[model samples]
Target: MTKTILITGSTDGIGKLAALKLAEAGHQVYVHGRNADKLTSVIAEVKAVATGAAVDNIGGFVADFSDLNAVRKMAAEVNEKLPKLDVLINNAGINTTASVMTKDGLDVRFVVNYLAPRELTNALLPLLKKSSEARIVNLSSAAQDPISYKAFVGQERLDDKDAYAQSKLALTMWSMDLADTVAADDINVIAVNPGSLLNTKMVDEAYGEYWASADKGANILTELAISDEFANDSGKYFDNDIKDGAHGDARGEFGQPHADALDKEAITELERQTQTVLQSLSA
Candidate 1:
């Protein structure tokens, strides 16, 4: 079956590779990027690899996740244009940036890696509910750290790596929370640590060296997106970093996330803090 799928940050890295492979597999893929030109070129590249009618069904959207308003705009466009969405791959993330803070006064890493996806996923719930079985794949990290309340609201600052880890943990926490919310509606939300130090631009910028191929991450994402193997797996964290002990195998197994992700009190506090931040964004 050809399912409609959307992959955020598909202009490069594992996200791009996943989009191309998914398109080649004949699924309707919607690619997104922060730059319009790059997004257009990526769409053509994705189409080049697509098979059958999927070539005509390829779509593209451009949004800078660092901006909450831009995320909202893109969500509105996606809701209006795409009838329904079967899979949503929240693959956009950053470990470093020129500026630590976005124009919204939030840490750039938290905004792009966590809050943007949270907002976009919520906005697209209507379309997701239309599917027989919808899947939400959140790109988590093996670097999860305990979130600091002071830093979450932009009251205190953190180093690049700290912010990134905290943001990924935040995402994992929310993924678990959201899974319970929509389980009855047939929406399965899963968090995955694609792989540690894959050969991607983000890795090159942050670590200056990578230990595995980006395809290792892309393969797991593709499987999670469309494979019935994971049809019933929700609120679970897939740890690709555990594959083959070190260098990583494309096929990963389900594993546990940080301890905080499983804490009822922590999840409740996270939800409260998240709502407070989001409400502040509107105010």
Candidate 2:
């Protein structure tokens, strides 16, 4: 059956590729981009590549995720447009060259990678509940670092790598907590480390090298979004780089999440800090 899917940061890279894959499969695909021009172009591109029957179902939304208010507005627009959403892929993230802090005085990485997706998912929860089954796929990474609350709040400075890693960990922690909170609703929430150093714009800008195709990430995302294998997998992390072997064994088949992601203490702290930040944003 065709599903209704929304993928954020989908103008390029794995997000865009995943959007194309879903659209081609005749799913109603909603792609988002920060730039209006680029979003329009991507919608056209997806339509161009989509099967003729699927072309009409492709759409786009524009939002600058760096701003929490913008994210809220975008969520409102999405709720207004889509009656029910089957899957939500939180794919927008950054290792920035611009200012590391947003206008609201939060770290850009934290806001875009964690806070925005958190808020968006909350805003759209009602719509998600309308579906018989719903999936939330959060993009995580292999580079997670312990989150420093001060750094997350923009009070302490951190290098790009430090900031990015911490933000991803924050996201993964929240994913687990959210999964538990919504389990009774029949919603599945999974965090994904979409293959370390895959050939994507973010990887090239940060590391200048890549180990695998962006499709490797996109493939897992597509699977998690719709495949039955993941139907019962909630509040778990899928480390795509470790297929079916030991953690940190980069050659292993990717399946389970890293050890840190499963830490009870870290997960609790992450939830506490995330709630604090969200409250501050709302206030």
Candidate 3:
């Protein structure tokens, strides 16, 4: 069964590698990014390495996840195009040195790293449910261990640089919580800390022109995506830092237990709060 796998931010790094790897495994992969030019190159690379895979046209989507309006439009369009999705990889995120504000009046890190993934996953829930076993993989980080307050939504009034880590923490929390909610439906929502890849362009953007790649980091992501054994593993974090198992620190102590504690009341409150905010903003 060649399932349809949708990966966000596949223009580079772990996401890009995941796309290529899944394609090689004969899955229909849809690669997404904010820039068409970047996505064009990604599609080319994926096709080159796809071996004997049963891939589709290699979808190229351009929507900056930082923008709410853009996210809504993307959800609508992607929903229409894909009636059923087997996997949804929430891999698009950013680590910026300076804080920026999106059009929706939310912190850019919160929007890109956290809110966008939440919005997109919510919008695609219906399509995901259509499939027998759906997997939603989120790209989380061990850096989210402490789950800092500075990076939390609106903690800093749009100037704090640590928002990146904070937002990642939020995403990890959400992934765990969502997993428990959808587990009964057989929809596995898991997050993995793809470890630290060496020499990737993302490092160059944040650090400098030179940084050593995590010799084994490149292959860690693919393991989670393509491994049949891990196919049913849900609500767990992959510590790319660890070779055999998920890094215990990726979600910190609050991750799994926290998600386990999310009752119907909590989920309803969260949904209401988020929907109110989104509707207010859109209005």
Candidate 4:
């Protein structure tokens, strides 16, 4: 069965590769990017690689995720264009930037990596509910650190790594909470650490080195998006970096998430702070 999938930050890296793969498999693939030119080019590229029938199924959206209002507008556009979304992949993230502060005075990493995705997911919940089964794959990381509420709400400042790690942890925490909140609706929410340092633009800019190919991460994303193995795996975290004796191999299997991701106290605190931030944004 062909599925309708939307992948954010899909103009490049694993997100783009996954979009191409899904499009080739005849799924209705919606690719998103921050740049309009890039989005147009990627849509064309996906269409080029897609099979005969799937060629017409490729589409795209453009939004600068650093701005919450932009994310909201993009969500409205998505709701207008897509009747139902079978899978939503929150793949856009950043650890290195020319400026770390958004115009809203929040850390760029936090706003783009966590807050924007949260807002987008919530805004699209109704459409997702329309599907018999829907999957939400949040891109997490192995670099999670404890979230500082002051920093999270922009009261305090943090360096790039600190902010990025906290943002990912916050996202993972929210994923677990959201999974339970929408369990009755059969909307599966899963947090995924694609890999420690796969060969992606973000990794190259941040670490200058990679341990695996981006395809390794894209493969797991494609699986989680449609494979039946994860039908009942909501609220779970898939760590693609953990496989015994597969450390040097790029094709390692997935494992459980960091202990903090499953901690109720931490997750509750993250939810509380996230709500506070969202409310402040609205105010």
Q: Which has the greatest lDDT?
A: 1
Q: Which should have the higher lDDT, number 3 or number 4?
A: 4
- Residue pairs with colliding backbones in model 3 are 198-213, 198-214, 239-247
**What is the per-residue lDDT of model 4 for residues 1-283, given as tens digits with 9 covering 90 to 100?**
7888999999999999999888888888999999999899999999988876667878999999999999999999999999899999999998999998898788999998999999999999999999999999999988888888889878899988999998898888888889999999999999998877888899999989988888888988999999998899999888887773324434444565656778898887787887888888889
Local accuracy of candidate 1 as per-residue lDDT tens digits, 1-283: 9999999989999999999999999999999999999999999999999998998999899999999999999999999999999999999988988999988789999999999999999999999999998999999999999999899999999999999999999999999999999999999999999999999999999989988899999999999999999999998999997866548554668999999999999999999999999999999
Give the residue spans of candidate 3 off by over 4 A. Answer: 53-56, 97-99, 145-155, 158-161, 209-218, 243-276
Ranking 1 against 2 by lDDT, winner: 1
Report the C-alpha lDDT of model 3 over 1-283, residue by residue, as the tens digit.
7778788888887688778777887887888899989888889888777655554446767798888778878888889987699888888888764547776556787778888989999889999999988888887765553333333334446434356665676677677779888988888877766655345676567666533343344465555555676776887766655533442223212133234123455445445655665776767
Stretch of 10 with least lDDT, candidate 3: 247-256
What are the candidates' C-alpha RMSDs? 0.8, 2.6, 4.4, 1.5
* Cα lDDT of model 2 by residue, 174-230, tens digit: 888899999999999999888888888988999898778788888888998999988
C-alpha RMSD (angstroms) for model 3: 4.4
Give the least accurate 10-residue stretch of model 1, judged by summed lDDT.
Answer: 243-252
TM-score of each: 0.98, 0.93, 0.81, 0.96
lDDT of each: 0.94, 0.86, 0.70, 0.89
Which residue segments of model 4 deviate by more than 4 Å? 244-254
